[model samples]
Target: MNRFALNHATTKFWDQREAVEACARIGAGIGLWREPVAAAGLAATAALVRDAGVAVTSLCRGGFFTGGDRAAIEDNRRAIEEAAVLGAPELVLVCGGLPDRDTGIDTARARVAEALAELAPYAGEAGVRLAIEPLHPMFASDRCVVSTLEQAVELAAPFPAETVGVVVDTYHVWWDPRVFDAIASAAGRISSFQVADWVTPLPAGVLTGRGQLGDGCVDFRRFKTAVDAAGYTGPIEVELFNDVLWSRPGPEVFAETVERFARHVA
Candidate 1:
């Protein structure tokens, strides 16, 4: 059986309390969002998940290098600290894109590398691995400068294995022509594998139209096969941010995610 998990963004309709309950009840792990963690109080959120015996797959987001400013870097560092406190194994980084008014992807990538160099040592000491999430090219303008697995791997070259890695999310990377080869190249360093489907007609430029599993273009079985072949033995987490799913009750969404995991991914 595939080990299914939930990214907290999918349950945006629920408060932290409900999110935890859903995960615990369904034997699912969680990928947490920074806002919910802050709102619930990091310590309290950590304790709640622990008390419910749920595993946290990854902490959703730490990087915003495009800001290329002191404040953004500090915020990223704090995210690492929060991940450590929660016992999260990986800190998923959606490295920011161009600074306000910029339009080049190349410059943004250079900034990401610089910021990664700064945080790697600190993240290593925190016992947390920085999982760089390569957002889809659609977000190249404002969300993440890193948009391909090859680029993501190259970006982690300067960091040690324990300090840095990459996350392979189907929603973000499914369209990459080199995805198969990249996964093979990633080998043991693919820190997290998040699953979600891609939808057309993006609501806005900021990446908000993620599709539910089996509801869109993603082929989870093939993707999971690739991850497994690459020796990634971690959980395949479901992470979606669709307005429709977000408007539904937490329990209903939880049930559908698990059903899809079994029907399609397994």
Candidate 2:
């Protein structure tokens, strides 16, 4: 399906050029990561994707605004520019978690709002949407403060939909009882839809434990139906972060991911 996409993180060890070529061969869109793009050089990466005729659906991340790090803002601006160069429409933002001292979730969330207010206009100028991604609560203390789709929508409300929006990742929001309602409320503000099943016995880092499509408990059909009902007709990016998958051959992993997506999500 044209709507099925592969997020680069799914094959973390794959060479970026090979990944692009693979997507081209399969006629699938690709979601890219900044590290590999940087390793390949921005202009070169852009040329490779353009030559391969693979649509760049979205960029991995751009936000980490909770600590009041000035460099973070500048880095996000650069990421926006990179997304534009790659023809990606959205730049995913994982708004950072609490600072080291004195602040709690409320303060962290407030800072995210402030950061969005500052970055939204810049993203609009770059023709890239700042997509606020709500990581799971387990990551709220160290990785992200935006922990729910509802919070993401509220944080994005003040900004124009063209400039700021939210990311709907099944792995992060499946546990939220209000997720369906949040998806409906997101409506036109949904900038990206990422899929990754959730598995237990999380690893030491808990960063690469995402399950393959049917191997976990997420209800993919329901999420797909809900997002469609919310008027989101965008690419469905499969973004599993699994160490086991990364240990396999890239082509094998990619093929298996596509088959699983067809069976469980598409």
Candidate 3:
């Protein structure tokens, strides 16, 4: 099953073209980010992947809907269009967190649902599924209100399977007590499955501290087994957001990621 895919965030410092080529060389799929794709020019990036025969499993993001900005919704529509241009079937959405300290989480979560209701049809029409990525609870205050796989699944439930789904990123959900049950419940709703280990003593902002596979406490095989039991037969993307790995050469990191995936995830 060609299950190994590398998410661009893992190699944040690498040039977009070089990263895509590296994935192509290994016959692996890639998860692209919007900023780099825009920097390379959407058409150019699309052509680059097309010529290299690299599949774009999903786009990095397309949400931040709690800010009361009409522009956020417009931006997501554009993201859907970009995913279509890249022949990617999934557009990952990191639903934004509380708008302010005074704003309640319930309000923020409701806004996410409202935004999805508006965008789901557009995504379906463009032949892309909106994958809600539930960031960890640590990010609940400033990054994402969708803080658990269960929340992601529930938010996606009201939409059509082809229109909305959830991302099962181990780094974010591994600590959850009910994660296994959540994965099983996700079943056909899992649009993307990303892996990254969990490490201790987080970095300053806690943004780039994701551990490399086999480096920390995640039980990747358990996750793989559960997802498989739930009927997921798609790519398993390795998406580590770590500063240490970003300092090394892109190929070196990519090679190591493949080795680790074989040892811990595949």
Clashes within 3 Å, all models in order: 0, 0, 0
lDDT of each: 0.86, 0.93, 0.93
Give the residue spans of candidate 2 off by over 4 A.
none
lDDT of 1 by residue, 224-256 (tens): 999999999988888888888888888888888
lDDT of 2 by residue, 164-189 (tens): 99999999999999999999999999
Candidate 1: C-alpha lDDT: 0.86
Global fold similarity of model 3 (TM-score): 0.98
Which clashing pairs does model 3 show?
none
**What is the Å distance of residue 30 in model 3 from its true position?**
0.2
Q: How far in Å is the alpha carbon of 174 misplaced in model 3?
A: 0.4
lDDT of 3 by residue, 53-162 (tens): 99999998899999867999999999999999999999999899889878798988999999999999899999999999999999998889999999999999999977
Using TM-score as the measure, name the better of candidate 1 and candidate 3: 3
Clashing pairs in 2: none
- Candidate 1, residue 44: Cα displacement in angstroms equals 0.8
**Each model's TM-score?**
0.96, 0.98, 0.98
